[model samples]
Target: MGSVDLIASLNARGPTSGFTDVPDNDESLPDDFQREKAKLFNPLKVGAFNLRHRIVHAALGRSRSAFATESPLAAEYFRQRTTPGSLVISQATSEIVRTSVLNIRKAAENEGRDQNHIKIIASSTTIVAATDEEAFKKRGEYLSYVD
Candidate 1:
């Protein structure tokens, strides 16, 4: 019979560590926690706007932009997430008409395409979840630090 090893590992296919190494009465983490608050939670004044929080919700999806025609849905989408003071950017929308924007080759091929028929750019940086938005901005800051 094989002998069993008594040394248990939390992440090694065993139970997780029951508790943190820090004492139950620990206060150090509490004090340090605020220092690490996300910029999304902080307040900032961008131009004429005095954002409630520095958290800028960058371009998301068409839901936050002109819905097919830059409708109120786009404005509502942004309004839903933004505070009175904060700024909410709508999705990166096209500034020009479809007929004028598409190149000759592509335009000729898709000239009769309806607005709804246009493809959504899935690879667009806009449109992110709350967590993703936070992490995305953080990563941007991190990358800039090295540059």
Candidate 2:
């Protein structure tokens, strides 16, 4: 092997006290490109999923459900982006059959008034979202498959 390959192999074995890099012209990227480019920023795969690009969308707290109940407005927003080949990392969804109690409580708390009224309503909603065994089981199964 050449000198560069030899260096890489040494690094991989974890005994190397230093590292080296081969220089190349990076200006070959498109003139319109605005972001810095590097090999570490390249795309990677995790089993059956192959990312088309290096960009990753982080999970968001959408405050809604896939079936459109929590906030129909939030559901509509996610639905609009369901087109194929788009990379959208979504927030953790509620277990199927779950409701919007967390969101309702969050909204009331943020508004900062009517503490007693909101607490009662929030408590009731929390009870409604908490009573599902089957849904939680299904959620666990789904996570297991992904891992």
Candidate 3:
């Protein structure tokens, strides 16, 4: 049914509808108490990956690595946040590679459980310039290495 129709049907049910056993507008509990209790904490299939929880932890770039490769510290950092069933989004520079992804995944694996349960997403940002010349200049500056 449409949203309006659904709302009308819900409203028609009044405080106690057959839809749920919990009381409607019960002041005894907090606003979200019933809703939170009803939520499923079970594993769910998201696309091809099975997540343990619905919570997602997005990693912020902290300048942990100076090279294109994922540093040991970065791997451990990402792994520590990979709670069961939760997704971890790791932010890195443009030079992120396959090994970095694998390292993060490996670190997230827990004992007696498959490592694939914890999903890891790698994200990067691209620099944009107003003009072609500016873009090239920016790219050149980014690619240049200083020792």
Candidate 4:
């Protein structure tokens, strides 16, 4: 079925459909809120990655590492925040961090779970400007502060 059809089907099933809790007063929803909610809660396919929802949990530096390595507690921190059909972005730059993520994935797989539902994305940042001149200017400004 198409996206609209799927949403309609979901909505028709009411709150107990297991997708999401449909509010009883759905008719009172604003048009913009309904549109945004549809996009936010719907499954998204970007390139080869199929996301269950558009909600993205970006990783923040928690200063949980010691000696430039991820601590065991980091794994627990990640585990606590992870939910089925959710994406997690890890900004860890250490090999230990990568290993922890792999271990988590393996454990989930061994339990006969849908491993695809748990997505771990290694995060990075890039600065972009509207024009080449603006980008070049920004780069120069940034470079001036470097020793």
Number of colliding residue pairs in each model = 4, 0, 2, 0
TM-score of 4: 0.37
Which segments of model 4 are wrong by more than 4 Å?
1-38, 94-147
Top TM-score model: 4
Best-to-worst ranking by lDDT:
4, 3, 1, 2
lDDT tens digits, residue span 1-147, model 3: 443443334333333243344344432333444433433434678988898545455564355567545677667656655545557876555445577766666776635456777666654547799998999899888868523
lDDT of 4 by residue, 51-122 (tens): 777766555435656654556666665554455555777665657567977798889999997777787766
Compared with the true structure, model 3 gives a TM-score of 0.36
Using lDDT as the measure, which candidate wins? 4
**Candidate 4 colliding pairs:** none
**What are the per-residue Cα lDDT tens digits for candidate 1 across 32-79?**
345236454466877677776554556544533444455565555555
Off by over 4 Å in 2: 1-42, 61-69, 93-147
For each candidate, the alpha-carbon lDDT, in order, equals: 0.46, 0.43, 0.55, 0.62
Tell me the TM-score of each prediction against the true structure: 0.32, 0.28, 0.36, 0.37
lDDT minimum window of 10 residues, candidate 1 = 1-10
TM-score head-to-head 2 vs 4, winner: 4
Alpha-carbon deviation at 106 in model 2, angstroms? 33
